[model samples]
Target: MANNSLLEIKRSLEPHVGAKVLLRANGGRRKTIERTGVLEETYPSVFIVKLDQEQHAFKRVSYSYADILTESVEVTVCNDEGQVRIEYLQQ
Candidate 1:
């Protein structure tokens, strides 16, 4: 059942590949980081975001959908048509 749910989330995100996204995550020690990137890919267990690099080399970050489900991360996807979708994994 758990695997099925993850699959569903993956499917929902597939269409948003290449869409702009804002990722907000809580680092340790009460610190948080927000990144803007393109939704690069969605794998079975995780999703990748290609970060917009200004001064450094290209970088990609991967986070499991479970992070959203656990509220450890928040993802906001903005489509080309000006539609925005926010996803958070819930129990």
Candidate 2:
């Protein structure tokens, strides 16, 4: 049952590689971090986001589909004009 949902989540994101995305994630200890990046790649268990150079020191971050399912992270995909497409796991 759990595996099916993970597969569903992965399928939802596959078409959006290379799109712009806004990410909100729990930083632990009651902190939240937000970032804008291009959706770099998606794999069976994880997806990577390449951060905008001005806002973060790290070049990239990866999150598992379970993180979204559990609501610990949020991903909002955007169009070229920067409008919101879909939001999930909005922590």
Candidate 3:
């Protein structure tokens, strides 16, 4: 049942592939890592973010949809107008 719910969230994000997004993830011990990237790809259980490397080396990060659902990770997609579209995956 939980898998089905996750699939729904994944589907909702499919159209945002290639869109610019800000990713915030908890790194444990009160640390948080934030990055700006393009929504590179989405899979059955996870989505990848291709990070901007202007200030550092290029990197790609993946986070499960479940993480969003649980608020463990936060993603904010930016539209062409420069407005932020936030997705709050309900529990």
Query: Scored by CA lDDT, what does every candidate get?
Result: 0.80, 0.86, 0.84
Q: Which runs of model 3 end up more than 4 angstroms from their true locations?
A: 56-58, 82-91
Report the CA-based lDDT of candidate 1 relative to the real structure: 0.80
Assess every candidate by TM-score: 0.81, 0.87, 0.85
Please rank every candidate by TM-score, starting with the best: 2, 3, 1
Model 1 residue 21 CA deviation (Å) reads 0.5
After superposition, candidate 1 runs with Cα above 4 Å error: 55-58, 81-83, 88-91
lDDT of 1 by residue, 1-91 (tens): 7666667667778888998898889897998888889999888799999999973265999999777766788888877677565564446
RMSD of 3: 1.9
Q: Highest lDDT, which number?
A: 2
Task: Indicate which candidate wins on TM-score.
Answer: 2
Q: What's the residue-level lDDT of 31 in candidate 1?
A: 88
**Steric overlap count per candidate:** 2, 0, 0
